[model samples]
Structure formats: C-alpha cells, structure tokens
Target chain A: MTDLPIVLRFDDVSVRHSGSHVDAIHGCSLEMKEGEHVALLGLNGSGKTSLLMAAAGLLPHEGTIDVDGIRLENSSLAEVRRRIGFLFSTPEDQLLFPRVLDDVAFSLTTQGRKEGEAREESERMLEAMGVGALANAAPYELSFGQKMRVALSGALVHKPRLLLLDEPSGALDPPGKRALAALFAAHPSAMLIATHDLVFAERCCDRFILLEAGKVVRDTVQIGEITL
Target chain B: MTVPHAHPAHPLARLCGGAILLCGCLVADHTTVAGLIVLPAVALSALLLQRTRLTSMARLMLAGTLFYLPVVVLASPGVALKGLSAAIVGVATVSSLGPQALHDAIIRMPLPALVRLLVLQMVHQAEVLRRESVRIHQALVVRGGVDGIRGIWEFAKAIPVVWLPRVLFRADRVGMAMDMRGYGAIVPAARSVRWRGIDFGVVFGSLGVAVAAVWFSALVLI
Candidate 1:
C-alpha cells in the first residue's frame, strides 16, 4: 500500500437508483494510484456517472469506498468532499454563482478563506484557464466552451487531491476539447473521467475502465487494446 | 473573470431603500409625486450603473400605457394620472434594481445557505430559459421553411417541445453537480457585506423619506 500510494479504492461497491430495480453500478472494484488518470467509458445509463458519484461521496454505496486511505461515510463526508473536485458534464450544473469569478472562488470561500483572498485566487485560476475576460459575466452569458473552461477553473482552483470529471469534452469545440485535454495533462491530481468521447479520453488518460449494464466489463491499462 | 463590485450603497441600504419606495407607492394618495420622484431615482440609478439604453424600458411602458389609454381617454383626470403613475413607478423600480442588484442583496441576507443557493439558481435559470427560448427561435428562423404567421405558430409550438426536454435533462445534471460539490452539507459561502457610514446613511435616509411621506399624506387627508 505504501509503495503504490493509492489515491482511491473501491471494494465490491454497488449503487442503485432510489426507486429503480437495477443497480447503476454493481460489485465494482478499482484502485487508482497517485497521479493516475483513468477514463471511465460506457454507454448512457451504464453507471459511469454513478461510479464517479460514489467516489465523490455524492451517492451511497453498499460496500466500502476510500479516498487517500480515508473511508467515505457520513462522519467523513465533508473531509472527503474537501479533498476531491467534481466537474459536471454540463457547465450549467457547476457554474452556480452569479458571477464567473464568484463561481470559481466558491470552493475556497466554503473552505473558510476570506472573501478577498478567495477572489484573488479565483482570479488567478480564471486567468490560468484563459477566461479572465469573462470574470464579471454571468455564466448564462458565456459561450458553451467559455462556461466549460470557467467550470474547470472552479473545480481546480482549490487544488484538490483528486478530480472527478463527467464528460469534460461533451460540449466543447475541437480546439476547446484539445485545450482541455492539455490542461488535464498539466494537472497534478489523480483523475477519473467519465466520458463517451473516446478520442478525448485517449488524449489525456493512461488507462481505460469500461462499464456495461452497470458492471465493469473491461478494465485495461493498455489504452490501444480497448474498444467500445 | 473579475467580479462586479456591489452597488454604491450597501446591500442593506439598497434593501431599505427598496422597501421604502414600495411603501411610499402603497400609501401615497396621488401617483404623480411618487411617480415623479421614483422615475428620476430609477433613471439616475440606471445612469450610474451605465445601463442607460432604455429601449426595453421604453417599449414596456409604451405597451402598458397603450393598454391603459382607453382608461385615460374615458376616465377622470385623477384616474388617468393614477394609472400612468403606477405603471411608470413599477417599471422604473424593476428596471433600476434589476435582477443583479436584487441578487447581490439576497446573497447578503442572513438566510440559510441552501435557500440562498436555490434563490440564486432560480434567478439564473430564468435567464437560461430566456436564452434557450431565443436560441430556439433563432433556429426556427434559420430553417427558413416557416414564415409569417405560420412561422410564428411553428416557433411557438416548437419551443415547449424542444426546450423542455433539454431543460429537464440539464436540471438533473445540475442537481448531481450540486450534490458532488457538497451543496447542502454546509451553508454556501457569500460575499461578506461591509457596511460603511454611507450605507447607514442611506438606510436612515430611506426611513426618513418613508416617515415624511406618511406625514404628508396624513395632513393632506385631514
């Protein structure tokens, strides 16, 4: 355990929708080491989101899930959340603040930093994301690509240990998708990205974990070997 | 992106001023004075905020006045003045404060984090819906097959069918996003309000106006 420095561990974990008969994910087990970037590939409703949600502690599971050796449970939810950054498939979902800057600064403020300091850091993050010009604009006013970049900035501003990205390439233009992949390449945190964009996943991820009907049908370290 | 600073007045001051204007409109015997005072105030605020392009405001007021024009022609002078003043004041207040100011003020309110977050999102959702509606209309226009009244009918029919599904899907995604970000676990963070002397003065001044309006109306009634 010490040699590999596992950042995430899922052991026999399963999740079902509240009123549904089928489990979204069933008996899935996976391990991610520090600096690992894994692509979660699946069709719609195949539990890619559910798996990411479970890792982020957003959904309850039957089996144990741990992040950086910390168990995800009611008592540890806040700590778990603080250590992970989750980006939604739609930028609209995550860019909730009135101003783009405020949205980017949200995590820092929630972590008890002063507003000024948070804003300063948020500005730096937006600038780094190449969206500094959109700081004061409402999220609704931004283009889809701009909003995505801003959402990415918000997720990464606090520098969490792990990132859970849901379809980061979904709405982006080709150039935008390429830039996002490059940005992910530079990020230091471990990441598990759920996406159907195979080309995009190949660009940024070193491993592919494929799901089918809520079960892990394929998990391969060799990206070239996998096809969905 | 740079965050826009709060209004010149503190959030509390703006709230109190809004309340005062609302009360004055409610009690004043004649709409003319209230309209005269409030209209200029709104215009001044708009000018300060640099939102001076008044096309929408003008269009709305024109439509409202046209709707009430029959009343103006047939009713007594007092009745006409009342209708026009009410419309003017209402539009002026809404346009001046707008959603952004109210949003800023709402964030400063000592409400629960979840409530504030919901309110903010609701405001944004309204904008999103409006934008989506416009996009749908634009798409209809680009199709170039539908035209005139037929185009209007088709556009109207298509909006709900096309927009609703997308909105619903987006809503689910948003809810999941909020959950992953730990939205309800703790109160959401808001910009801290710093009330300066001017903020206090503005609040008090609004109170004074409210009191004076009450007195003037009372004496006139007597």
Candidate 2:
C-alpha cells in the first residue's frame, strides 16, 4: 500500500475567491494513494469546497497540486481535468445536455470518440448506475434521486482515475445515500469527497480529513476515534 | 422515463411547417382578412395537435396580446396583429416540437459549427436563467416577500437586484463545469431521428398552405 502511486497531491495550497480579499483555503496539504477513498469533513464555509475546486484547477491557488502525477497548471489543466471526475453539490449544474444519455456521453464525445461508441459506453455506465431507463428522458422530468444517479453516471462514464465530489449526499434520502455509498465502494477510482454526512463518509471512505477555517485540523484512519 | 413527446413529429417537419406558416403570414398583406384568419388558424391547429391545455394557451395568448398592445397604439393595429400572429405561431411550433428536439434538429442542420455551438450555448444559458428565476421566485414567496398586490409589485422590483447576480454566479460555475468536462474540444456527432409518414405529410401540407396564401393575396391585390 505504501508503494502505491499518489493519485492526488495538494502541497501548501491557498485559494482566494475572485474579488475577495480573504482566502477560503489557506496552506492546506494532503495526498491520496491510488484507489484510496478520502472523506473531507467540514462545517459550511470551512473551505472543503475551495480545496476541491483548487485541486481541480477551477480556482487559482498558491503552491502546487498534482493529479495522476501531472502538475495542475494552466498548460496542464486539460490533462489534469481529464484524469479527474468532478461532481458539483447541485447535480443540475453538471447535467447540461437535455437528454440524460447525451449528458453522460459528453465527456467521451469531447475526447474525440465516435458518437456511437461514446453513447454505447454511456448507456453501459447508466445501466451500472441503475438509471438505464432514463436515457431518453429530459433532465427536468427526473426526480432528485434519479437526477443524482444520472449525474453520477455522467461523472463516472469517462472512467477517470480520481473523483472529486462536493456534498454528494445533500439531496439524497437514507436509501439513496446507502445506494450511493455502495456505488462508491464498487468503483476503483480514488475519491476526495467533501461532505457533512459522517455516516456516509464512514461507509465509503477509508480515511477522514477534517478542515477548520481552511486548515486540515484532523487526519485519521478511524473517524470515530477523533473528536471534532 | 419516457420522453415528453411519445411520438413526436420529425424535427425537420416541425421546422418546415413553422417556417412555411410564418412565410405565408408575412407574404399576405397585413390588412388582408384572409391573412389574419389563416395565421390564428394555423397557430390554433398546432396547439391542438400538441394537446396543449386550453387554459394555459389562453393565459399565454393574453400575456402576449397585452405585451403587443403598445405596438397597436404606437404603430397600427394591423401591424400589431401581424406581430402577435407570428409570435403565436412561433410559440406553438416550439411547444409542439420541444426544445430538446429543436436543439437536436438545429445541430444537425447544414449550418456552420460555430453557429450551431452558439445556438446550443444560448439555449442552455436561457434554461439556466429560467430555472434560477423560478427558484428565486419560489424563495421570495416562501419567505413572505409575496402576499398581496403590493407584494407582487415589490417582488417584481426585487427581481433585477436579486436574480441577475445569482444567475451570473451560477452561469460561471456551469461554464467551469463544462470546461472541466472538455465541452468544446470536439463537436458532438448528431443523433439520427426517425421520420414518419406524418412528417412528409406535414412538409407537403405546409407547402400547399403557403402557396395558396400567396395566390390568395395576389388575387386580392388584382
């Protein structure tokens, strides 16, 4: 396990939102081994989202970040993003295509794959996520839980090495949460999930990193062993 | 999980039908009674075929007519009527065809790649804005910002102040998401839609209507 390659690394990173003077994430550092699932736990505005966004190269940050051994920089941004799958807190924002299948096929199509091939792969992914029946349905017609599953399908379709999820359990009911946990457990990609649901984190992740005011306050193998 | 239109008319057929109807209306003299009759008739026919609720259609017509009332006063009633008729037909065609179907058709059309992309992006941003507006409106209502006539007025006043910033922020986030997912790297291949017998009938029928309208207009002029 120690010899496994690092899938993600954030080295002394600080991030400030545009037009804001205060940093949302300040001097945070962490690393994840290949296929390791890490839960990021924090209060609202504790910079869990900022850290994830920074690692995805969505926000300008000081210091360095790496994905799949590739540095996150303007020139390397595309390559880095290609190696990571990002899920927003609101699934609506990520599911852009009118049809569910088209949305799932987008990343592959953009990578210059043939349309038929991309769609075939997307259909398979949707089937795996248990949303195969919704391939032709419009995004507006779906229930929240169904929409979440479709969005997850879209994220995972391209088969990236790492996943970055923000508040993934926010809209899910208990059963939906459990289903999501099971889905993550089955996927091989390393994940950095920013969430408030301790139970969800415990079910899917092997490590927990708690953030307080943009700093890593706790890093533990067992979340139950630590006091918040 | 089925699409809204279980057996939708082919998108090309819908597009051609709308275009033909619009052209027919535009070619006829604004003051001609036949043109006025035909325009509303075509719109009504489209609405009926789409199974649109009568109450909703009436509400839309009322709002649209009220919006063009200024044109009736400032320009001429005939010009206003023409504009209203065109708008009605446009709306009916869009409702019948569905935005997703329309989008698919437009992308597949023999247009330049940039133009297709521009249309797609515009449609997407419009949807985003609409969704945000609905959310903001609901929030306002739930928070007691809406109660009576005065509340409605205040809510209307607050829209620009509240909605614009939120929509802009959301648009930025959505754009970032798109970029991260490699949106513009390559043009997506168009999906093929099955055409039916009704599709051919629609195109031919529209052409016939357009031709008859043009002939009728010429006869009236003579």
> Which lDDT values do the candidates have, in the order given?
0.74, 0.80
lDDT of 1: 0.74
Count of residue pairs whose backbone atoms collide, per candidate: 2, 0
* lDDT tens per residue, model 1, B3-73: 23335666545655555554654564553444434433432332333232466557756776677778767
Q: Candidate 1: where are CA atoms >4 Å away? A: B1-15, B23-54, B62-91, B97-102, B109-118, B140-169, B183-222
Candidate 2: true interface contacts recovered: 0.63
Model 2, span A1-228: residue lDDT tens: 699999999899999998998889998889999999999998999999999899899999999998999999899999899898999887877777778899999978876778899999999999988889999988876887888888888888888899999988888999889988988977899999999889999999999999999999999999996555
lDDT of 2 at B155: 68
Candidates in order, TM-scores: namely 0.76, 0.84
Give lDDT tens digits, candidate 1, residues A1-228: 237688899999999879988899999999998888999998998899889988987777999999988999989988888889888777777777668887787778777777789899999999989999888987877888898889889899889889999998997889888988988977889999999888999999888999999899888877777777
- Candidate 2 off by > 4 Å: B1-8, B19-59, B75-79, B124-155, B193-222
